[model samples]
Each structure stands twice: as structure tokens, then as C-alpha cells.
Target chain A: MPPEVEGGETTERVLQILSTSARLFATTGYDGTSMRDIALACGISKSLLYHHFADKDEIFARITLGSTRELVQFVESRLPEGAAPSLRIRAFMAATGEYFQRYRWAWIASTTAFWNDPQQRRQTERMLWRDRYEGLIRRLIEEAIAAGEIRPLDVPLAGRLVLSALNWMHRWHKPDQGMPAPEVAEAYFDMIFHGLKR
Target chain B: MPPEVEGGETTERVLQILSTSARLFATTGYDGTSMRDIALACGISKSLLYHHFADKDEIFARITLGSTRELVQFVESRLPEGAAPSLRIRAFMAATGEYFQRYRWAWIASTTAFWNDPQQRRQTERMLWRDRYEGLIRRLIEEAIAAGEIRPLDVPLAGRLVLSALNWMHRWHKPDQGMPAPEVAEAYFDMIFHGLKR
Candidate 1:
């Protein structure tokens, strides 16, 4: 086989390992899981697992960074170019809810019990990504306010509230239960855009 | 000493242990702590500590249960008697925010790393308390809708969104920086009740 094919095969195996580990970590939690457990779950020898990754922390960092990047990209991709600020806000909220719904394990893994002993690099990566994400939302809110699409308010607080609600969806959203992500997003949008007052 | 006085001293000691352990667990996480650490922090012998509580797990259970009870009581006490639905909603939101602010350690300890290996009883207790809390919120929403104080929507979903925004405050709220708890509560109330649409 050519060198490129060999490299591609190695990349696929690494992806498989990361995906499997993410599921296990999400379900059992980081501390509750071990490298041996991951190896067994992946049906690979310990040495082989080590060859693909340095350790469990490396695998965890990869998954978290990967998930965060994907979430950002997913939201950005869904956002319409040159759309009204209100429409942009709706798209952001809907995409966020849907991303959490689809990548439930990734969200769980990034924010749950494993956060206690995060590597410095992982923590920095998360903070940077979070800042960027929040900055985007804050800008959108500012735009909406300037456009007179929404009332003036605390931009940072407003952004935080919206992000918090969307982030919390992973904790309770079950694909099999209740309304689908789109409907849930619609209800949330209605509530956020229109005051609860009749 | 009189029997009553002796019992009172014992109760004080138990409370001391619980308070100190809650701080430690909150700051360092449960798995990061040990019985020895708790004993040192409490300035007591490990044997004495064990005498009061069977183990760390027991201590954790006691703190969590106590905190949950206090949170329920706090919200209940703040709720005005025979008030309008909107007022009741305000009280609930304010109380929820304040409870998390005051009992920051308890909220941190209960929700963080130790949640993975929870005893069956602890899980059941958490579920029971959560059900009660959510039920209360849902009822308030239903009452608000009936009173035409707010538009009709999915009661459970609305309740979750509100609770999520409140609960996520612990992750980001800084008492010394930015808005205080009451101010934060007011902003949330405004956004939640009045929405963003002008």
C-alpha cells in the first residue's frame, strides 16, 4: 500500500478510538473509566492503544477539543450570511440545541465530572473557545439591539442566559422523549423573543 | 453537664464537620478529598469523625440532603402567601438565585465529580428532591398561564429553561464581580417575563 493509504488507515483507527472513548467517558464518567477499560472496549491491546495515543488524558483532550470545534463550526455553518440580527439569533439557538442533541456524549464529556482535573492545555483550550463562542453571541445581541430588533439590555448577561439555557439542554434532552429539538428550540425562541407577559 | 447540653454539643460538632467537609469537597472535589483530609480540616481525630459519620459517603449524603432541604425551605419561605402568579414566579426566581449564591459550596459539592458513584439512596434522594422542585416550578407556570399572566407553553420545558439558567449561575456568577445575585435575578426575571422583543 502507498504511504498516504497507510496514513489514512492510521487516522481512521485514531478516530475510532476517540469516538469509543468519548461514549465510555460520557456514560461512566472520566474517573470511573480507565485505559485498560478503554482498551478492552476498543478490542485492542494496551500497547496498540498507547501507540495511537499517549494516554487517557490525550484522548480526553482530543475529544473535548474536537467536539468544541465541531460545535462552533456547526453553529457558524448553520448561520445565514447577511441575515437579520433576530434571524441570526434564532439560527444560533436552534443550532446550539440541535448540536447538543446530536452530540450528547461530547457535551456530557466536556462539562460533566471530568472537569475536576482538567489538564492546563485542555482548560485553556476550552476557555479560549468559550470566549470566542460567547463573543459571537454578544455581538449578535448587540447587533439586534442596535437594529431595534430587541430592547437594550446587559449584553453579557443576555448572552450568558441564552448560552446557559442551550447548554443545559444536554442534561435533560432525550431524543426519544417529549418534543423534538426544533420544536423545543421554537418554544425557547418564542419565550426569549417575546416576554411571558400576555 | 446536663443531657440536653451534651446532646447540643454533639450536634454542633456534627454541623461543624458537615460545613468543613462541604467546603473541602466543593473546592477540591469529592474524589480529590479523603477522610483524613476531612478530619484534619475539622481538627478532629479520624476515629471521632468516623464515629459521627460512617464514612465520607455518609457525610456527603448528609450534607446533600441537608442542603436540599434548606434550598426547598428557602424557596418556600420566600414565596409570598396568596400572591399573584407573577409575584410568585419572581419570588421563586430570586430565591433560587440567592440560594445558589449563599450555599455555593453545597451546590458545587452535590453536582460535581462525586455524582458518578452515588449510593442508590443518595440518587433516590436527589431524584425525589429534584422532582419536588421541578413540580413546584411547573405548577407555578401552569398557574401563571391560567391567570393569563404569561402565555401558554410547555410547562415542563419552560420550567427546565428557567431552572437551567438559574443553576448555571454557579458556574459563572461572581459575587465580587459584575452584578450581585439580586441584580442578576432581576435581569433574569426581566428577560424571562418580558423577553427581548420590544
Candidate 2:
């Protein structure tokens, strides 16, 4: 049984299991931890865990979906259309970059596993994210091109290039090292916007 | 127990094992694989596996070292210093990015768990690579700035930013998509070096 804080809804319980699972999964990789371990860690019985989630696969899919939605919402809300192309691009990437700081493990796990045994759910998640991110970047490239703020390049490929830079933040960034996510994002934004010029 | 293929002292068996293991480690993740499986897949005895590599960790170390050396060599070798600053910067990033295409998995693996692990050997490899890559980048940036190619910005940070773009290639690129790595790098090189200009 999950904590009463989740109320009596099974979906809430599933979500609870998922949140706890993501935290645990992030620390211990998916293969290293077992369902029994997850159930024990989450304070739920095996049957109840099964009742809420069919298996680890189901839970991972659910968590990934939630993560994708949260990312989309985060970026969409942060974007101010009326801003200059440069500013808009900064805001856009910064929001996503900062969000990655909290949830870097998801990226760590998902990105490393993109080509390996991509389950149907994982494939769907990949498509959704790639399309959404590419679409957002397409707009940025278009705006920048129109304003002559940046150089003309393939929007989809350019988006991939920018996303690649932001994606690695989780790999090397350490919060205790005194760098905040927003600051790192700004550094990257500065690199993207102005480059290494005085 | 290991097939001694005729070739260089490294041996075809050695190369086969390395390439296969690299893919397995990248796909299944290091934590998910076992020596038994690797041995079986390579058609070698576990003892033979040990002959070629001490153990799983050693294999991991070699892969990291091998890929890093390849990267360091490629960057240093391909970046012609006498070229114009604009051309040099673009060529430098393009060559580096092109490396990401074939060894995308190796690059991603080296930069993450291999770098993050507290193990001394991995750490040493990480530092070696960090210094080798960053040192080259610093030299290039200094030259470019002195030559009045780009505005003087933080060289170290700019190096990291540029690298992040190239490293993320493992996540999004698909060989089946028909876009060659060189072409991809060229496209991104234009975006990074020239910016969005008419």
C-alpha cells in the first residue's frame, strides 16, 4: 500500500509508485533493481505493485510520458513570443536546460538506451519528444533567420545540434560545485547567441 | 579458446571482442552485461576473455581510452592551424562532430558513467581526455581570438559548449536516416561559426 497522502485512487498510487521508482531507478539502473526491490522501497506489496503497474516496463513508460509532458509544459510556458529572437531562444533553451537539472537521470537513461531494444512505448516517447523539440527549434531557427540574428541552416539539424549541447548538462554538471542550472543555461545561451567573442 | 585471427599484434580476435563488447556495453549498459555472455558471444573461453581483458572494468577502461585517443588524434590531426580563423573554427568542429557519427555510443559512454565513476582508473582516463581535448580547444580559441575571428569569450566554457553539441549525436542520429556524419557536421559547423546571417 502506498502512503495515504496519495488518497485512494489507483492511478495516484501508480503515479506515486512511478515517482518513487524514477528516483530509485535514477540511482540504480533499471537492470540492477528488481520489481521486488521497488515494491519494498515504495512500501507496497508485490500484488499491489502489480495491480497498479503491470511491470517495470509499464512504470517506466508512464514516468517517461510524464517527463515528456512536463518538459513540453515547462518550455511552452517559459517562451515569450513577443521577445526578440535571441531572447526567445535563450528563454526556450534555458527553461529546458534548468528542467534537465532536476531530471537528468531520465535523460541519462533514455538517451543511452535509444537504440537498444527500443520498446514500443519507448519508441513512441522518442517520436513525441523528437517531433516536439524539433518543432519548437524549427520556429526559433525561422525567427532567427528572418531577423538575421543567426545564420541560415537546416532547422531540424540545427535543433539537434542545440539540443545535444543542452542534453549533456546532466552528464557533467554538479550542483554542489556552485553552478546553478539557470546559470549554466545562460552560459550556453551566451555561447549560442554571442559566441566566445569579447 | 580465442580465435587468433591473422593480422596486427592487436589480433582480429582482440578487435572483434572490442567492437562487440563496445556495442553490448553501450546497448545493454555496463551494469546489464555479464562476462559469461561476452565470452559466449565471442566464442572464447572466459579465461580467454581474461587474457584479452582483465575483466569487465578493464574492458570498459580500454574502450574509454581507445575512444579518447581516437578523438584526441582526430582533433589534433585534422585541425589545420594555418587556415583562416573562420575556416579553422568550422573545420575543427566539423572534424570533431564527424567523429561522433561512427563511435557515437563510445563517445556517450566515455563522457558519462566512465567519467562520473569514482574509480581511479576511469577518473584518470577522464582527466587525460579532459585535458587533451580542452587543451586543444584552448589553443584553437586563443588563436582564433588573437586572429580576430571570434569575440574573446571564456575559452574553457566555450570548449565545453561546443563539445556538448557534438557529443549529443549518439542520442538523435540514425544511420538509416541517410544523413552522413560529415554532412551533418558541415551543416552544424555553418550554424555555429557563421550564425544566422543572410
Q: In order, what is each prediction's RMSD in angstroms?
A: 4.2, 4.7
Model 1: per-residue Cα lDDT over B1-198, one tens digit each: 011212344487887788788889887777778999999999999999999888999888776766776677678889998999888988998988888777777777876633364677776876687778888889998999999998878788889878878878878887778877766976898898999986
Q: Report RMSD for candidate 2.
A: 4.7
Q: Estimate each model's TM-score.
A: 0.92, 0.81
Query: Counting only residues 3 or more apart in sequence or on different chains, how many pairs clash (N, Cα, C under 3 Å) in candidate 2?
Result: 12
Best model per DockQ: 1
Candidate 1 lDDT over A7-51, as tens digits, reads 344476776787788789888877778999999998999999999
How good is the docking of model 1, by CAPRI class?
medium
Model 1 regions lying over 4 Å from their true place: A1-10, B1-10, B113-117
Question: Could you tell me the lDDT of residue B40 within candidate 2?
Answer: 83
Shift of residue A193 alpha carbon in model 2, Å: 3.2
Which regions of candidate 2 fall more than 4 Å away from where they truly are?
A: A1-17, A39-52, A104-109, A112-118, A147-151, A195-198, B1-9, B43-50, B81-88, B102-105, B108-120, B176-179
